[model samples]
Target: MRLKILGFTTLMALLAACGGGNGGTNPPPASNTLSGTVRLGNKASSAQIASSGRLLTSDQEEFVPGEVIVRFKPSLSVQSVSSLSVGGVSLQRVRALGLESTGLYRASTDTAGTLRLVQGLRARGDVLWAQPNFIQRALKTPNDEFYPYQWHYPAINLPQAWDIEDGTSSPVTVAVVDTGVLVQHPDFAGKLLPGYDFITDPRQSNDGDGRDANADDPGDEPGGDSSYHGSHVAGTIAAATNNGTGTAGISWGAKIVPVRVLGVGGGTLADIADGMLWAAGVSVAGIPANPNPAQILNMSLGGKGRCADSPAYQDVINQLLAKGIIVVVAAGNSNEDAANFRPASCSGVITVGATEFQNARARYSNFGPRIDLMAPGGDVQADLNNDNFADGVLSEHRNDAKNDYDYVFYNGTSMAAPHVAGVIALMKSKKPALTGAEALDILRRTAHPLDGTACTGQGPDSHPGSDCGAGLIDAFAALQALDGGGGTNPNPDFTLSLSPNSLVIPPGSSANTTLTVTRSGGFSDSLSLSLKGAPNGVTGSLNPSGNSATLTLNVAASVKPGSYALTLEAAGGGKTKTASLSLAVGTSAAKPTLEGAYVIACFYLGNDCDQIKSRIIQVKGQTSGPYSFGDLAAGDYLLFGWKDLDGDKDVSAGDYLGAYVENGQIALVRPSKSGLNFALEEVQGTGMLLDQVQHALRSLRSR
Candidate 1:
């Protein structure tokens, strides 16, 4: 029931699309009114009427309670629409729009029966739409001048999303678990919520106490300087935005619940784990329940370790997931795969990597399968945007010598995680019921894959490289997906290639390949190149970091003969694209290949269709009758072959797409199912997207 601008063009589009023609002479189709929410033609004017004399304070109200705006059928007069009565209650027309003759009116009812009457009006044949006069919030953009330099917000498309919802109405709390926050910073002024200090060791808490409720920063610097790390992170997520102050925050309307977990010398695992649960609303023995539990938790800290090794931390994450609270953690800043980090590697959390201003993975940002996505953590070296400012993220900081608050730019995965945390705030503000898994999926599905390139190999000796996550977090795109839309930047609309698609070499020998990128679609941006995947005992390197480069693959003398597949990604101008490379160490003749036009894999039994994973192959254009899919693990699986017609990469009803059915299931204990074959058949969309998919897999038993 958000009060939006509802443009004239949009109204016409809705009328035309919903079968309402002749200037609302006909009622909108039932399908259009299924949601039973109020619809308004002029949202801005309506908001002005509602907020004319309302009190403006920190505890500001978003919408008028116990009231709804109703638009009667065009045939009905304004007087007639307002004269309506329900259940012995008379509706009052407090305001009207569209010349006094039209039927739009803002009506009032007692709070006791507001919900019931609103629903009843929506069902009336005389009513066109009945919507609650939802409290409208001002666009949540901050007026801090330095906000222009904070390029991270635009990189993730935050501004576009702010127009839809500023996250003010929903009381979504984001718990920042870090060193501590400078509560007096101007940017964080009335936004701080009551938080707790979890540092049990008095020496580390630096407050001369242990486990207290005061969550203030005591400055974690060794030389008595303020670390400001926690404060910086907090500002990124919920600084006092749009107040014409310092810097704008992402979710300016959401509350900041600061939980001090890390301290002067770094925090212990036990303290961190306990703080996480407490922030999530779980009561720790002897401690009071957190009255304001967070819907989103931001942990911008991590250490080296496979998450599976920590049973205590993993259990807490599961608990938070069940509570519908999303946990976002930073990938370690060690420039290694995030899979080796503790909570970043933990399941049920979204792990974020860092990206430079140029949209390439930040040199220090960790990556790998565990990494969910990337955000601007900042890179000071290259001025891709030529803004004359370092690309590092900017936030509130305490200048020790001045003994006052200031701003500073810092880089790390720690900085990257909060960007995601803030975006989650926006998502939860729009849809409060989103579960942790749903948040991750929405992020992944809407993410702009590394400008169009996949993260690959390291760069040079002086300039280290990074393998990024899915891509940059496009906040606007995510909201669009939540609203049933898709990606907007179709850039990287170019081609990627290797001079030699395949290479052959022997032990102690080397091979050279040329990586090239061909730009198209008016794309003239310089591209950054990266490589990934060299077989065991073989290493690959790209000479330079641009559109075209030479790749050198050095094979160790101890390496065995085999074939390997490698990936190359190119990023630039807010776009990323990728191409695959193949290398042969000695011989690939011994490798087993699957025979199929298209391949489908169903794993993790229960005979679950939900777990069904499929791949479409090109057979009609291939000169060979049979194709081989390499190296699948041993398991009981169901395989299918299909001719993809719609090119959506999935089987759907609208297209002539068909899949193989008979004798598709196989037991690949070893080389047993090598020669299996099947044909394709037409199927409906329901078969591809229905309950069968969800029924295929069951949850893994936690220890």
Candidate 2:
């Protein structure tokens, strides 16, 4: 009566940095880069645009031609400084920065003598700031030996994803619902959470008992050959990364919850179904609730029957989907239509096929409308990396003796499924609340089309060539899709933030922060938390409490000393917001560095809340220098350093000792601000705004 579910190995860019030296038209030199704030006088009017190209906003709003943001001293009006001419230049205000109304303004001028105009403005008595906008680059290279050969990472544009995020800041839990993982594997150290064995039949449960809580693999050997399927799959999803050891995982910061649903002779559909539910933290009859439910579920095992014949499995998939857990499955390796497979053919699961390094579908991979996309599944016969090693997917496996951890090459729809699963984990790590439907959509929409144009055909169904799903899954493009093009959300519904926004730690030390996600504009759906951009030797952990999470950052003694940009994101209800922080390692009090800060203000525009700008500040102990906020949209605003002094992400009464604020709310006429140098003051009042900030800070402390 048990339907045995067998394992199926399913078959399957850096932009130039701004440089200087060439000419006004020549690209900036790759090495000579600049980083500073640009300030304007009046908000640039439409007619004030230069004679050449009119000002246009790039994604960062810093690429507008003939314009730089302007910040005026507190209590100063745009009109007061509007008449102060520099050379033949004139100034006009565009808008405020975020919600701030008075201090900051976007200014425009004729393109001629642009550099000279900036110099002239800086010297003026009325203008407080003028500088060129600086460009930042993403980390493109990892020093790992096999990284260059990981055509999979670059093929999917993971370097670009790395620029945006790495899994370190907000670690997401991914359930590897397969044979069982090698808990003692070095690559999986500290990465495995408590898991359960769902195999009810003692005969197939090779570990001696039936339906136990131990999820460690005892080595699945059907005919004297141990298949380290789970270990390999788990490694692909979260192998110890950037450790100068083995290959890196797509989402290296993710944690794996190994739920053993299959054993020696494989497992039945019933056990697999229960395992899937349990992986999502759903209650099973006799098993304890999974304390660390997975945000993403990877199922590389399936039956060879159409989903229509497996109502039970299909229902579990739907339930997992409804719970906001992304389900990723392998397209059956039978070289037939995936619609003939159990979980792969089921609705609501992302069915992935295998692709070789040549971008062609693997010879044994299934193909059909049901297949969602493809990923590097490796082809053992070829050495695509040309390193003299087989191109099979390299991951943590077992030695022939089955007693120690080793590396092995594997290829199948089973292998391809984990790549997609790992990518989904990466997406979830960046936007934790991404729904199953949304995850599926992003995979399909952002996949590199493998329409058989790039290489010769392969796969059993390959006639004209390879005919798989959309194409190779692109990690970078998929992550970009999560940002919804990195502009204003037309339906601004939720607001999320991380306290402390910046921190400093010594080598071998650790730090902590808090993240808060608040529903707004009528948002009610649940949201998920994720962290991105931690450097090597640093790991981020998230313990969630309702809409808030406490994030802890741990650094290894050997972590290289440098400043890292980190992001905290919350995604749900089909929308997302990201807050950033700066972590400087091996830094000292005497050598302080101004990481970054933010200010909130209200406006008269579309939403009552105008803009939230990242305010630039000096290092903690700096005595005096003008702080500037550029390209601010017009509105009334309040400023708070929001320094999580204790790293608790809260504004306690004692923590407010050095609170900084302007005399009162400033009304901005343009998108820049300067002067009105404010000093730290003791708590002056306890109003609704203060209460709100305190309330947000307390969310992280609540649990």
Q: Name the best candidate (by TM-score).
A: 1
Please give each candidate's TM-score: 0.50, 0.48
Name model 2 segments beyond 4 Å from true.
1-149, 222-224, 453-456, 463-466, 486-703
Global lDDT of model 2: 0.58
Worst 10 residues of 2 by lDDT: 6-15
Whole-model Cα lDDT of every candidate shown, in order: 0.60, 0.58
What number of clashing residue pairs does each candidate have, in the order they appear?
A: 19, 57
TM-score, model 2 to reference: 0.48
Please state the error at residue 15 of candidate 1 in Å.
86
